[model samples]
Target: MLASLAQRFIALTLLATVGTAVSAQTLSSDQRVLKIERMAHGLDIPWAFDFLPDGSVLITEKDGDLLHLAAGRLTRVKGTSKVLDQGQGGLLDVLIPRNFDRTRRIYLSYSKRLGRGSATAVATGQLARRNTQLEGLRDIFVAAPPADSGRHFGSRLAEGPDGTLYVTLGDRGDRPSAQSLTSHQGSILRLNPDGSVPRDNPFTKQKGAQPEIWSYGHRNPQGLTFAADGQLWSVEHGARGGDEVNLIEKGANYGWPVIAYGRHYSGLKIGEGTTKPGLKQPAHYWDPSMAPSNLLVYSGSMWPDWRGDIFVGSLKFGYIARLSGQPLAEVEQIRGDETGRIRDLREAPDGSIWFLSETNGALYRLSR
Candidate 1:
């Protein structure tokens, strides 16, 4: 039985690799003026980034390496822990706390190996400098045990203005698990900084539901952030062609698998087709999907025309899309004609846009 399970795992990993390659080959747009000047190579798939107060950037590679990029040079930070780098799993998101300059603390999310599969875990650690090496040395929060599956584990972390931690969990590739209140998969979990459940979470008083649950019914939300208006926004990849950008609300269900604008991989229809009475519809959705990953709402000064527009990185289309207008009516796929897979995008402290390329392992800085 163990051997059979291992075989299944290997097969899934191969499928994911093939799927990524197939998606990467499809992006052929020529609309972007930007070009990636490779700052560093030989780093594995760099997933997310956080800029420090000293003008350096901390980048997390999916294969469990931490890199420090400063003064146009990339150096690997030592003593980082090994991650369970399987399909759609690895070192995920990184964030420097709002008071990091004083507190010296940073937070991270990654897939940690359990018995056979893995579970998403978050850690807070100080930057320990020792003889030219920096290390993130401790863990603060680890989620409950997940079942033995190689998929989903939607591990993105976001901090609210009030400092609550919001973590998203994927459905573990099991669509039915999304509706189960007892499971952590397919849920947006809210917690205190030290891993305690928030008392005011939506399911805190509900019977059989986990208190960590803020909202449920998400598929695989890779992107999450708090807008300038204090509203939470998320971008999630739908099954075949229904990528979504949603305005996340407390205690609401953003239907996945149940009511998607996209279809199943086998070409079958999904759920009841987008209009359930209880579920909230997405603010924007992409059909013939862009495979949206990281999301950023631009309130920066460098791109004056892009102010208040939301930028989303696209893996399938190899570009960044900007969405704007009152009531968020228009969607513009800018920089879509750029090079490689646009994996993540973040706003720098000086109001510039920084992005990551997953395929070629490069970083880009965009300004007016």
Candidate 2:
């Protein structure tokens, strides 16, 4: 009787272990059926996309143009402001106001030509249907100093929960400017709707610091969004390998040139070692380099299983990566799509995932 009981117990234990292994594999499977339907094409390096209340989308092309798409049709909007249109400098991001349907207000970020170089500028305008073409119509805000640079002009904008606009500027390929309190480059800035600095900003009380600066020491923050926890998160491209997903906090310093998990393009060592006393560490880092561009946290009803997952677009691998947990473990990779460079990713009002392909200048809608 004792020998028979031992055999039965061993059999049950083996079955339980196999069951657990199978469950884990199913969670991380790449078999997700993602159907990509082309919505619009013929755009030039479409950088970002925002959805309107009536199911229309406003897309920004890197070559300084804005195209409006509605009901599977494309229309070039008129009255677009003049952009610098140099290498990596042009119109970048577009966002609609929280109450867009009632106000018809839109916000934009672009590099405006100024003297020797160009400066990243933010403007608010009204979208009006005049004559036959839709017009951007006006500018409500432009940066003051109007500085210029060819690289690292991080022009990403995100609206906060309090109606304030948050803007990010790269170091303009200048390493020292990132450490300068007076410079707007390599910093996350906070401002009111009309270009005024908010009093509650982190550096507003500091004498030498720019009042608009919310946080500093970023290389090139391409992705910014507020998560379900009401915490802001940003993903920046590291030099060679160290792409990072960071939890943004007010007045915090994220060590850039001073310290990084990545090395320079020429394979030289970057500033100081990886960890410092005061600097914040990224929640996650990609070693082999994913070339992360755009990030969005899934909060839709269509994919209930992906409700809390964070979706990141990759330019190097040409895949959409899904991350989960506080430290971000790779859950799955959605591959075999357009294979073009994905500049931006946004979740539409109808719970569909929309991706903007920079090389093809096309919008792809992904539905399960």
Candidate 3:
């Protein structure tokens, strides 16, 4: 199904608020004439997906299903690790290695149930076409100190320009853990393609520090993506209001509960105001909480005009916010027929925009 611009704009206008920080890009009705095409449906909160060079797509369902979508059909990819599928925990992110055509390796992040506890774990395996399953599965990274809580398993993956992979891990619903160096929770981890730690990891020599940590102090980062310039970016949820879009920096500390633009959910202040010494502020923040899920700095051909603009999926508002400029600001909000609880989004190899909608249980593509 194709969605018209008139229909999309009506939804966007309804959700549009007046106070978002604006950029130099002038708002015009002419640019609203884009289209949304339904790519797939009947998915169960399809969390993340990556496209193979052969035009096939691999998607991770939160319920532990690894599905291959090709030629208008979906097939279950077997040999997946057992996922806990509890509240906010399960098969979360799927990524095709940068050299997938040669290696056939895929990376996955899931909530691993280990004995009586569970934690976010990343494993890699070779994809086999003959049997439609992964082979030689082995975990390369696991968040230290397992937890019983089923929330905040930020598992989005993005390949850095240097061929290393970046993984986002949440604070495990334990606020203080984010500020601690001994824990892998609430930090962005950088690892070599084969799951080895980069020798120059930021905290490699710090006493009582996890060598895999790249950046620390995050709430529940759900989105990870590389900008056109190869810089890494993330989007994370705040307590009551302050959802954040951060530019991931090596060795930097992104202040979480201790210093946020949000409150404690009970209307109380969070941390030492919005700014404190040695803590990083967000590039952009949502005041009333958009419940941001993922970030995409578009370089797609379909939207040449938006080549360098930043796009983020907003879960709470059921829309995509088109942002641009440094210290990014919200420029526009886009909504289509199936755009409900946006989960993750990406630009296809063909330069089209593809996204998964958790609320609609479907996938969609924005194309010219």
Candidate 4:
């Protein structure tokens, strides 16, 4: 875990203070000057970001704005689809695939208006040469049976090593729907680059099952990432204190509303206990919910000691959580005023850490 490295970081400058820092046990006696620099500012609800082939960055704001940040300058990208922008729904995630340079294509997940209600949708488009607009935007996949309430729209996107796309969807405040394969609610979907269902998907041939469904029974899974070994991992929000980090597999049942470690908000027990015969247990979990937002498996290019470690952002506690070890437990809490309500965590191409703070409405980079 990076907690031990925290002791070696000596602050070189002080910014406006917003919260107290947590102390960690020293991992090494070698001290290095830690720099927390604000990269971009004046953002509003910036939900997600991804690196472009040209070394710039694309950031999405929950309110339907796509931002381009390069060399300390910010530009608003045009041609984004219209989003609901209510409750938890909005333009959420922006992703650049491995073949970005060749295709000039990018993907987005957002809350789209379906009928009178709203549902999660994924769209793809080409970034203009100027990086000032998105062109030919079109929806490839849209979750079904939209919900009236904007409570749970789990919209996160990740590209697989094999070029497929994985999209996470929430239960839409409908608990029972998680167990229903007829609906896309509370499910992880696997699709080809062109938005077609992969023939090898676990439920593709199953009767009465949604062909796109890869895994189900999840509750508000907002964080998803692939490990260096190609192992897929995800983190989801629980009702009260059951935030979870799960190792995802094909055709697995994650038992939300059927089995859970935490109870309902009203102090009532959830499901038929924590474990069921067909349900998968969380690889790691949090009680007193941290409101986890994004998940990252560090490459350790900058800090070799952190290679393969897990880093997650906590929206509720305003900190970045570091998890490592065989069993995957929290080894450190990296917090400060600049980290307030971290909405996203990304590892830059150069191996530094960049994150968006909702409370501060700015982008920050952590480096030594």
Candidate 5:
């Protein structure tokens, strides 16, 4: 979870009084008697999921395998790009575009191999099923300035209402680079589906800043999504502590190595303090660290009560943390003991909750 191959609440005055509140149902972790069914197995760190129009699910494994599961059949799709799969980097997030039925297109984000290191890369290609494999894949986006670090590949993809693709990148273990505008490390980048920088991006006019960057000062953002209100939110890893859930905004600076609620792994302090001028504070945070891997803003009908709640996969604590509040806050953690090392979670088209467990190499679904 850390750049070292390891893994805050708001400061009231520091937080802007403006922003939409996050709402959630008051369900406790122990209250749900939902059934947990193992949907798939033999996976290695399944990182992302999306339901196709035909009810099949597209899943991406961190070890560079693209799997298509339908009606209890699992297909290991071919044409997957080779991944660098070191420490925490590998084939990560997969997405089924809203226009998939007509376009037959799906998006993929992975650790693009470069020499001994890798950088986050995304590609979209027409998906056509042929027997047990997939074909017709092509690239769309590649993270600039690839670093040779094995940790902190914050590669997650989310599509905005207008079809803009949002990607999160880590500091790539280069802490000071996060504060630099010249580097792509530690930033949430926005791009067109074809991988070009948007003209209206936050830093487009800046001389040295990367044109794709939308927000800066992130540590290792592993999850990204758009809320019903069209607000972007992210969850990221901290060193020894200070895991954060942030409401992302254009050109906003999230104090990371500069200021953190979590201390160093050596038990020392971090940054000058938790609050500073100009930098943004997290909507919610965890001190002991959840080692969160992904996030979902639930608007599904199956769990009517969870309409506006945020679901997070807890890699370190092994559970799902549901967060909600007016200004966004941690509400409850669910199924800690039963679900082991959750890597990712998604709400199926049928309204069921499907989550991946890295520890068990399996996919589990929860429903009433």
Candidate 6:
């Protein structure tokens, strides 16, 4: 399927965006024509963004800025949490809950200073009616056993079908901690809206495990989302070439360090080969590591032919990868001059695709 899609991949670049009239590119792939436009620019390391109920956008800058973009203007949203802003630790994902229209509540995931080191934390706040500030912002959950390392916070948030929040946390560069149930490191946490543990959580009845843990044995899971069918999925950074997209399951263990398809940065083998008896295998993996940032399972409202497909932003390769079909495969790679270091890929409210480019410090939109 991958080879066939590669042979059929066709792209036609049109006029680049200059004044909000022309598009940056008119790309053709997967039998669809996609128009890419630069929606906003001059951002400083915009990591993640989500659309609000009023057609505005809330963007998170890794340097601790919450920007509200509306009417072609960027306004700084005050009263956000103070982040560490060291290494990969800083302001990250922004999530607008499904009930935002009634609650005006928003969620943010960032690297919070904990004791000596920084840990991934999730916070909620009420967006002021004026959209210029956040009111009553408070931390909901923070990962435990913070490490001194400044890498791999893995701060991404997704609201489950049941209104629960799921947060991804990295291993803090500690490989073995992924296998430990006592620590929240390298795990995906599921919590109620108020930061309390769900009564029916997978580990709530377990003796030593953290009650917030939904799944374990992840290295640095940055990309997290749910499909229309309510199934959860995640994409995580692997050692050298084993970047993976896994189907997240409750109480399941995804083998990291113990069994991985990639080798260490030192070119040494990881774990005891790829396959293990009990560990879960990835739905798909990339060799040479694309430094995946976010995952989106497209609904295909604009391009209906591509429904149920997966789109991933590549921070290292500077492109958006489209994965589809059963047993998932990388069907196409969308690249353009505007696609530098793609940081976040999200399906907008109108079914258009919005992505952040760290290399360009811009936000771009894609539609048919």
Q: Identify the leading candidate in terms of lDDT.
A: 6
Prediction 4 TM-score vs. true:
0.91
Q: lDDT scores for all predictions?
A: 0.76, 0.78, 0.84, 0.87, 0.80, 0.88
Off by over 4 Å in 3: 1-30
Error of 5 at 247 (Å): 0.5
Q: Tell me which residue pairs clash in candidate 1.
A: 154-170
Which tens-of-lDDT digit does each residue in 158-185 have in candidate 3? 9988889999999989999998989999
Where does candidate 6 stray beyond 4 Å?
1-24
Ordered list by TM-score, greatest first: 6, 4, 3, 5, 2, 1
Residues forming the 10-long window of minimal summed lDDT in candidate 4: 10-19
lDDT of 2 by residue, 1-368 (tens): 77864564355334333432331111123556665666766566788999888787888887776777766555557667888778778899988879777767788898888888788888777788531243555555555455556787777788899888888888888876777778888888888877788888998888888889899888888888887777888888888988888889999988887878989899999899798989889888898889888788888567888887888889888878889976678777876546477889988877788888777656777776
TM-score pick, better of 1 and 5: 5
lDDT by residue (1-368, candidate 1, tens digit) is 87974564355344433433332212222343432333334446888888888888788889787777665555556666668988888888888878877767778898888887678888777776421244556666665656677787777788899888898888888787777778888878888877788788888888988788887788988898888888899888898888888898898888876899989999999998988989989998888888888888888576566777898888887777878876664366555333468777888888867788888666666543
lDDT of 5 at 282: 90
Superposed Cα deviation of residue 202, candidate 5 (Å): 0.9
Q: Candidate 2: which pairs clash? A: 118-148, 154-170, 170-186
List ranges where model 2 is wrong by over 4 Å: 1-29, 130-148
TM-score of each: 0.86, 0.88, 0.90, 0.91, 0.89, 0.93
For candidate 2, the 10 contiguous residues with the lowest summed lDDT are: 19-28
RMSD of each: 7.7, 15.6, 8.6, 8.0, 10.7, 8.4
Ranking by lDDT: 6, 4, 3, 5, 2, 1
For model 5, residues 1-368, the per-residue Cα lDDT tens digits are 33322110122111211110212122234466666666666565778887888887778887787877765556667788888787888888988878888888888888888766678888887787552454567677777688888888898899989999999999998888788888888999999988898899989999978899999899999989888899999999988889999999989999988988889899999888899999999988898998998888998587788888999999988889888778777788786444789888887778777888888766777777
lDDT of 5 at 173: 89
Error of 4 at 363 (Å): 0.7
Question: Which candidate number maximizes TM-score?
Answer: 6
